[model samples]
Target: MKAVQVSGYGGLEKLELVETPVPKPEKGEVLVKVKACAINNTEIWMREGAYGTGSNSGWRPEGIKFPRIPGSDITGEIVQCGSEEDRLLIGKDVVLFPFTSSGERGNEHIAEDMSFIGSEYDGGYAEYVVWPADLCFDMPLKTYSDSAAFSVSGLTAWHMARQVDIQPGETVMVTGANGGVGSLNIQIASKVFGAKVIAITGDLKNEEQLKALGAAEVLSYKSTRLQEEILECNGGPVDTVLDVVGDALLAVSLKVLKKGGKFCTSGSAGGQITQLDLRILYLKHITMYGSVLGTRAEFKELLQEVSNGKIQPVIDKFFPLEKAREAQDYFKQHGKTGKVILLPKTGDDLQI
Candidate 1:
């Protein structure tokens, strides 16, 4: 099998495309022939040791194992099942759940033993991958590339919306509104949750597209009067703020929120650390939540919504597996809307 392996935490040099032996499924697992895998900031940050330093930089406290395959948002077809009872799954198209956890029901994402697919186990950046049979769900969209776009970013966005408890007709502000998670946040908060979304992005060119995705208004982050613009456009302070750009918009997010409003954050793409005055939290009575991936229940709901045509996949570009380094670089560039995909099969063999 051909795969891309991260030898260690570093730059693009860490990702190497190489030929390796195909892995067989263990008990309760199944082998999937890779179709499409989307690129995300999580895997890129993991490779750069952004979460921490030394042996604690990955999804787990033990850090990433050397030469690990790196992709989580995956869509593939089942080629083999580990047990006779699961043999019926073979030949079915599926999308991976992206994580494994022992936490009970609603508390799965916060469990002490939660393990991510690309980080804790070998992932779909290869021709074949083995995952627990129960974790694989039927693809929500007909195309592999469309189904692959959501597993990680969409799940994170869904969890954030749930954390903030967005309500119908409420004004919700979504920062970094052009990226994968940010774009999905706009759709889920507005289309699915029935909220009015104020989409904020660095580039104003995406304003039309963002509004098409259910945003009530689109504003550029470069505006000097951003806080005022948000308040005026919504007719007052927003009811909630869903942020992915951290330090860059933290102060403005708190300022434009209605008193006692909620703030939910899932990413820190712009900047990680920022100075905060305690008055912003106490004086305004703001409630904040730090969210990550969601539970099985949320994943199921997300899939259903996509299947129902309520949520749409936004794809920016596609690359062959061998050009992972270039793909990761393109993914990080500003102003690209939606997911960047990698296909293991080359030369028009796959319908990306």
Candidate 2:
């Protein structure tokens, strides 16, 4: 099997493609022949040592082990099962759930024993991967690439919307609206949850496309009067702010929110740290939430929505397994509007 392993937390040099022995499924697990995997900021941040204390970063406190395969949003076909009872899953097209947790139903994402795919276990940046049979759900979209685009980003965006409890007709501001998670947030909040979305992106050229995806209005983050513009578009402060570009828009997010408005954040692409005045937090009675990947139940609902054609996949580019480094670099570049996919070239001519 051909796999790309991250030797350590560093730059693109950390990701190396190597030929390794294929892994077999353990009890209750199944082996999947990798078809497609999507690139995300999680893997990029993990490699950059940005998710934890200085010089050591990962999904766990022990830090990531060296030479780990990195990819989570995966779509593939099950080829073998460890347990005889699970053999029915063989030949099934599936999308991985992205993580495992010990917490009870609603609180799974914050469980103490939570382990992420590609972080705690070998992931789909290879020709084959082994995951628990129970964690593999039927692919929502017809093609591997389309189904692979959502596992992580869509889950995170769905959880953010649920955290803020977006209500019908409420105006919600989504920052970094052109990115994968941001774009999905716009769709789920507006199309599914019935909220009016005010999309904030780096480019106005994406305005029409974003509106087609359900955004009520699109504004540029580069605007000097961003706060005023948001207020003007909504006719007042927005009911909620879904922000992924941390420090760059934190102040503006706070200022443009109506009193008692909710705010939810899942990423920090622009900057991480920012200064916030306590007065604004307390005086306005604002509520804030920090979100990440969601639970099994939420994942199921998101999949159903996609399967029902309520939410569409936004794919930006594709690269073969050998181009992992270049793919990661392109994923981080500015102006890209959606998920970047990696094909394992496993002889399955999967199409989007």
> All candidates' TM-scores?
0.97, 0.97
Residue-pair clashes per prediction, in order, are 0, 0
Regions of candidate 2 where Cα sits further than 4 Å from its true position: 347-352
CA lDDT, every model vs. true structure: 0.93, 0.92
**Compared with the true structure, what per-residue lDDT tens digits does model 1 show for residues 18-41?**
988778888899989999999999
- Across 206-289, the per-residue lDDT of candidate 2 in tens digits comes to 999899989999999998998888888889999899999999999999998889999899999999998989799889999999
Cα error, residue 321 of model 1, in Å, equals 0.7
